[model samples]
Target: MSSLPPASFQTPRQIFAAFDRGDLSRESFREAMNEHALQLIEEMEEVHQNPVAAWMEHLRSRRAAGKLGREYGEAMVRELLVALSEVPEFPLARWIWNADRPHLPLYCFLRPKAEPVFRIQKIVCAPFVVMVRVEYGSSEKSATVREKFTFTRDQVGRLRMSGRERVK
Candidate 1:
């Protein structure tokens, strides 16, 4: 039996396919669609305070604990810049900063000096950027690899992961 909670929601494709098939439960579909947005916004309030500063502090902490890999902080900040692209250039970022909203959740993996129980993986499609940093191996040996997945959010006013490209 796998320890990872069975993925709780349907994939974007699955939901819409079921919708087309006329077998979709509206409530289940809503909940399923909400899952990604919800996960992404888990700590959004905190990030909104000052996205740059908050990220800096987070990176600092990760570095202090020897969890962050080379340039991962810079990588995260760069990816963040892309994620908040338009909003930050205008006043929207400030608005979001002051708004009552949850903080964005980063799909980050922090490792101690130990072997990983399982590998982590996720797909994010963009103008939105999904940043991932992974450390694998054991206390005696390990390796860290970073990747950025870019996606363009569909503009039909629907929430979905539409396009994906492995940027590195």
Candidate 2:
């Protein structure tokens, strides 16, 4: 008897053999993959719905904290939540080509015990228009730092396409 679940029914060998030496359409492959994922999620939800299984999960969590220490267990949960909550906001495919190129100035702050030098780079738009203030540091040697606010879309676009010259 096979211990493999129904979700593993479509093995990697089968899928690859099915597409042997042939070009597969992007839309068709995407649809098939999406359906497979949905089915797996449904099966997992079913497994987690049992009362005995739920109690086992609670016991496991308590045991983990006892073994690892309370701080370590709490840190693990916090990190997991942070990872789960993070969504890639940028469009990766479109931005990949320009990722290496410098667009905006990145901001940096150095402690007095360290180099005593500070830099503010790649400052861009803020979320709110009226309520928030945007500021950047000047030269590290300077006594007074200059603050800059307000940026235009044209400025950002120009930075994004910095290397190439415009054709007349």
Candidate 3:
């Protein structure tokens, strides 16, 4: 089992680390976060039903080619959703996706008091269709040598890793 939320019940959080400290109401924040998540769920359901968009189509093609498996894509979606949950501002998530994905799965670890920085080096990006980059490693330890993984948006419209990541 993974520390993942069921589709209907997402784990609530402070959700606004990027916001300047302010006097926003907790209830308001929760309401806004929930609403944002609901909208994403609605979008995901739509894509899951009709995966015609480029990303979704790409995922389907990779799975059919056996370069990416269904579970792999699902895992990426789950992990991306979990990471996105930590971000409250909707636009911020999109920004992170565009600018920080090269360092993603890395972004999943973003948390307050988490000042430690790590470097990820990408080695390859062409092997798996789900791969956003070819290879990457942190400063502490490199990933499995030549063992590759990826993150992609599933038909459900959730961002998921391409392969299994060990979770305790």
In order of appearance, the predictions have TM-scores of: 0.28, 0.24, 0.28
- What digit string (tens of lDDT, one per residue) describes model 1 on residues 1-168? 002213333445556678778887888778776874574475466468668855665564455324222334434433333333222121112112211122433323322321221122332323444433222233333333333323344455323322323323
Q: Write the per-residue lDDT of candidate 2 for residues 1-168, one digit (tens) a residue.
A: 001123323332234444564544656555655655675476457547765754554454445434433433333322222221121221111112222223411111111111211222222222221111111122233432333223222333321211211111
Lowest summed lDDT across 10 adjacent residues in model 1 is found at 88-97
Determine which window of 10 residues in candidate 3 has minimal summed lDDT. 111-120
Models ranked on lDDT:
1, 3, 2
Candidate 2 global TM-score: 0.24
List the candidate 2 regions with Cα displacement exceeding 4 Å: 1-9, 51-168
Candidate 3 regions off by >4 Å? 1-15, 18-20, 52-56, 60-168
| Model 3 lDDT per residue over 71-137, tens place | 3443443344354433333222321233223344333322111112111222233323344322112
Q: State model 1's lDDT.
A: 0.37
| Strongest candidate by lDDT | 1
